[model samples]
Target: MNATSGAPVNAPAELHDRPIGDLIRDARNLSAAEVEKVLSYQREHGVRFGEAAITLGLASPDDVLNALAQQFHYPLANAERRLASPELVTLLQPFSVQAEAIRAVRSQVTMRLGQGEAARQALAVISPASGDGKTYFAANLAVSLAQLGGRTLIIDADLRGPRQHEVFKVSNSAGLSTLLSGRAENQLIQTVEGVSGLFVLPCGPIPPNPLELIERPAFALLIRELSTKFDHVVIDTAAASLGADACVVAARCGAALVLTRKNENKISALQDLVASLAGSSAQLLGAVVNEF
Candidate 1:
């Protein structure tokens, strides 16, 4: 119900705004009579307006959660209906502990990323091996960054074992690999259906020579080109143990975040991975231990 903070006359606020009751009223299109009933029930039952609305079957539990999320200026997509991958906790459970932890990581990454004279164009999420939760972290982190109201894009650069397209529920028939290989696809970049300010460039078909494709200058050129079109570009890369794809991708992006699974990732391997990334020009934006 609130207008944009310094917006001009006749300008409306973004759908994203404050207050649970007002947001619910607007979102559910409640009538005046419905609002009065909800308020009276809320007062009589000593419950919140959203609770009253849900109790009266005027609004669903998902509606109440969405209103609450709007009040706190956070983003939430229905867990039951968002996508096939429930691992994107930032969208599916924005208030959960896992989501909060990922947001904390986002905050740190953003702050560190903006400190330099020349801000980095993109960030590559890399891990030493598969099953290290690299794809999961990249997908969730992209959602969190998009929640900051910036146009954020997550590129599925892991041509070997790409999962971002599946995670975001976008078609991977033609994406980064196809685009880099000079092949034509109907749609290369896709706007994620539910989450605002988020986009995905899937890995397309799995190339037999993923390393060779990534090693080509076209891949770096594509990252640079995409950087100009997006506010924040998050790249999901292949595992370092698989090849040098992650390192090369990170070097091209100018920044990298190292991810490791708890108990499964060896300390020595992680240290060596850090050293390898450090040797490159890419700024090491610190490492994340993926416990989830």
Candidate 2:
């Protein structure tokens, strides 16, 4: 009949600063094995109930909501709505193999560029030819960077054949081309919904002279502008061996990720592309082995 004995358990404050395992242990009052199950659930669904509890330094749902509202300028009920939203939940999915590979490349590039210089602004993902999985790699890589808490922008620079929208299953109605033409810069820069810290500039309608658009001084200026707004601006460029577009984009990028497939032609093509870019100032950060 004791009130305290029958009361529900509450999470500890300052949970965010604590190790995830420790937070889980404290919150659920469970054994290590049981806590791991909850951790697994959080990773799969992108729902970090224990982590959120810690992040907001709260012991109960109401306290968490109140803390977020007070610190983040969000209304208490609105904060609760957002926290319970499925979109927010999905953002918590654990990193996949593809994300890890992309992270490896990002780390290599950052090391080569050195902390301040390399991490300065923009990064690009390209290949020697089509079907090398450049777009897929770029999309996953951008998501990876976002997961690491960096604001990322994935630019679809493949004007000849824009595929990023299709990869992310997002719209392509208004994008880079539209922005360039002075149509809708504001509208074209699409915020990737549900995925925090990630935005996309899809390649709108294909232009007849993609090379011309890429080479213009305005294009370089555009790159610079985008770089300022995001921690990492990853461009999915056309295959270098296919045309001059990728090279132009590469020149402006801080570094490029060269992708190669397992087949002999693709490997040989990648080598040739590297040789071609060797003369320029653009640095080939490293080659990614695709489908291997």
lDDT of each: 0.85, 0.67
Candidate 2 lDDT over residue span 1-292, tens digit each: 0011243477445434545445345544666666556566667768765554444343455444344333332222233334543222212322345545566766776677666545765777778777777876787677667656657789999998888887655688878777666676455666665455678889988877788888888888998887776777889998876698887788877577778877734456767777777776677777778863
- The segments of candidate 1 whose C-alpha lies over 4 angstroms from its true place after superposition are 1-34, 43-48, 54-61, 70-73, 115-117
- Tens digits of lDDT, candidate 1, 1-292: 0112366788766555656788899888999999999999999989999899999999998898887777666667765446576888888877789999999999999888884434547999999899999889999999999888868899999989999988888898898889878896476778886777789989999988898888899888888877877778999999988888999999999999999999998888888788887667899989999886
Model 2 residue 80 lDDT? 34
The Cα RMSD in angstroms, rounded to one decimal, for candidate 1 relative to the true structure is 4.5
What shift in Å separates residue 110 of candidate 2 from its native position after superposition?
Answer: 2.7
Candidate 1 has a TM-score of: 0.86
The TM-score values for the models, in the order shown, are: 0.86, 0.67
Spell out the clash pairs found in candidate 2.
Answer: 15-54, 16-54, 46-92
Q: Which regions of candidate 2 deviate over 4 angstroms?
A: 1-96
Error of 2 at 5 (Å): 42
lDDT of 1: 0.85
The prediction achieving the highest TM-score against the true structure is 1
